[model samples]
Structure formats: structure tokens, C-alpha cells
Target chain A: SAVISQKPSRDICQRGTSLTIQCQVDSQVTMMFWYRQQPGQSLTLIATANQGSEATYESGFVIDKFPISRPNLTFSTLTVSNMSPEDSSIYLCSVVLPKSGQGGLGGYTFGSGTRLTVV
Target chain B: GIQVEQSPPDLILQEGANSTLRCNFSDSVNNLQWFHQNPWGQLINLFYIPSGTKQNGRLSATTVATERYSLLYISSSQTTDSGVYFCAVLINAGNNRKLIWGLGTSLAVNP
Candidate 1:
């Protein structure tokens, strides 16, 4: 299993400020993603962080509000810009670990998640 | 786009009891996985059953890809099992791949 180390486990930020969450994977992975879990809700995909290229954002999500940077196969960061109280949620970084003896598609592993509270 | 649906929006059980959680997908999937989100917000992978059955300890999962549904069984539940159980499916669209998720079943195992 690939382990992901996420920083700033939880934070309290004022409205309109920006926060960047980071994730470092223990091994190189081809697929890395960012997800948001709103209070008492299901996880929603934010974007796919492509190494050396711009991220692919999901519908209802944009690059302006959520900028992602994947410098390499094992590192990525997600920035929440101009945060608001409604933006308060748990942001998680996930990576897909290729199955053994298979060709690069497997279960997804997630970071511990960053709980952001905007006031 | 694929839709994932989980049944029994919520569940409550006493310790030592057993329960079953289900997941249904609208389209074909390349992979299917079950995850448990602990209270601390860590997603622990429970099973990766695209099809057939697999068991680990008291937890087991069965997926019938042909039927487009999966089931997760937990026996002799413990308080530690109390949390949200999510089912996600991986689907490929042309050159892109995405994992669609279910709303999840909120389970509470009481002591």
C-alpha cells in the first residue's frame, strides 16, 4: 500500500484567505486526485493532478478556486483560494496504487485529510 | 458518467451483531472498492472487489459485476467499526478515467 503524508491536519482560516494543503506519497504513482468531503456528506472529486501538466478539474470545480500542482509523481499540493465559510470541509489527497501483476490500475489510497474551517 | 448508489442510508447495530452493506453501479466499471472513513477522517481501504468475493477477518465483500451490484458483510461488529462506509467505482471514458462515489452508508455500532 502507498502511504500519503498530508500536512496541516486541521486549520482555522479567516474568510477570503487562501490555504494550501500538501501531500507526499511514499512511492511514485501515475494517478493522483483531490477530493472534498463536506460536513456529513459524501466525497466529491475536485481534480486530477497531472504531473508536469495542468490538472483536470471536475464539473462544478474550476482552476481559479482550486489550483493544483503536481510537481512529480510523489508530490502534489492543492490551494483553496479566497476561502469562505461554505468552503469549510475535509480535503483529501488520493493516489491509485497499481495492483500486483496487473497493468497500472488498482484501488485508491487517501491521505488523512485536512479539516479546514473558515470563519 | 457512472452513478453509484448505496443502500440503507444509515444503520445502527449492537456490538456482536452482523450487518450487510450494498452498492450498485449504473454502468460497467473497471474496478470497485470499499472504504471505511474513520472518525478522524482517514479513509481505510476495506476491499477491492471488482468481481467475486474476498474476505479479511470478519469483513467480507462480494461483487457481481454482471449484475452491477456489490455487497459488504461485517460479522460480530465492534464499536471501532462505527463510521461511514463508502463504495467507489472506477470507470474509463475514452482516454480519461474517473472514480464515481456513492453517498455512503453511515453505520453506528454500539457497545
Candidate 2:
């Protein structure tokens, strides 16, 4: 299992401000993703943070609003820009082990999540 | 795009009771996994059953990929088992490698 240390577990921010969440995985991972869990809802994929490349955003998600940075295999960050009330949610970081994840041996790993509230 | 649906929406069970949760996908999936979101908001991997049956302690899961459904079984449930259970799938048909998710089943186990 790859452990992820995510910072700023919870935060209260002003409407115009921005917040950046960080995740540090215990080991190098080829696949890292950012997810958002809306209030009283299920998890939604935000984007796939690729090391040394631009992230691949999902439908209805854009780079300007939810920019991600994967500086290396073990480190990544997602910044919620120009925060608004609608941006408030529980943001999570997830990973997949390339070797073990294949042949049904692999699974997704996740961070504890960062709960954000924009006022 | 794949649609994943989880049943019962919400569930409440007395401690020591057994419960079953199900997940159904709209299309075929080569990978499927069950997760437990604890009260503290941590996503814990419960099972990675893309197919067949697997048991771990008091929890077990079975996935019939051919039929596009999966089941999670919890026996002798405890209050600590109360939380949201989610089924996530990875569809790798052609170039579609996106991970699809279910709305999840919220469980409340009381003492």
C-alpha cells in the first residue's frame, strides 16, 4: 500500500482566495489523480496529474479552475483557483500501483482528503 | 462513458447483523473495486474484485463482470462499519481508460 500525506486537512477560505492541496506519496507512482466529493455525493474525477506534463482533465473540469502539478512521481498538488461557494468540497488524491494493479492485483490508493469551504 | 449504480441508497443495521451491498455498471469493465469511506472521510479499499469471489475477515465481495454487477457482504457488522461504501470501475475499452464511480451506499450500524 502506498501511503499519501495530504496537507491542510480542512480549510475555510474567502470567495476570492485560492487554496492549494498537497499530497506526498510514500513511493513513486505512475498514476496520480485528483478527485472531488461534493456535499452528500459520490467521488468525481477532477484530473489525472502527470509527472512533468500537463494534467488530463475530465469532462466539465478545466485547467484554469483546477490546475494540477505533479513535480515528480511522489509529489503532486491541486490548486482551487479564485474560490467560490460551488468549489467547496472534499478533494482527494488517489494513486495506482502499476506493477500490482495489473491482472486484478492492482487497486487505487487514496489520501485522507481535504475538506474545503468557500465563503 | 460508463454508469455505475449502487443499491439501497441508504441502509441501517443493528450490530452483529449481516448486510449485502450491490453495484451495477451500465457497461463492461475490466477492473472494479469496493471502497469504504469512514466517518473521518478516508477512502479505504475494501476489495478489488474485478471478477470472482474474495473474502477478507468479516467482509467479502463477489463480482460477476460478465453480468456487469458486484456485491459486498458484511457479516456481524459493527458500529465502526458504518460509513459510505463505493464501487469504482475502470473501463478500458478502446482508449477509454476513465474511472467510473457509483453514488455509493450509506450504511449506519448501531449498537
The candidate that achieves the highest lDDT relative to the unseen native structure:
1
> Whose TM-score is greatest here?
1
Interface root mean square deviation for model 2, in Å?
1.3
Off by over 4 Å in 2: A99-105, B93-96
Q: lDDT score of model 2?
A: 0.90
Looking at model 2, the pairs that clash are A100-A106, A101-A106
Superposing every Cα of model 2 onto the true structure, what RMSD results? Answer: 2.0
Candidate 1 local lDDT, A1-119, one digit each (tens): 78899988999999999999999999998779999999999999999987888999888999999999899999999999999999999999998877776433358989999999999
| TM-score for each candidate, following the candidate numbering | 0.96, 0.95
User: Would you list the clashing residue pairs of candidate 1?
Assistant: none
CAPRI quality band, candidate 1 = medium
Candidate 2: tens digits of C-alpha lDDT, residues B11-90: 99999999999999988787899999999899998888789998989999999998999999999999999999999998
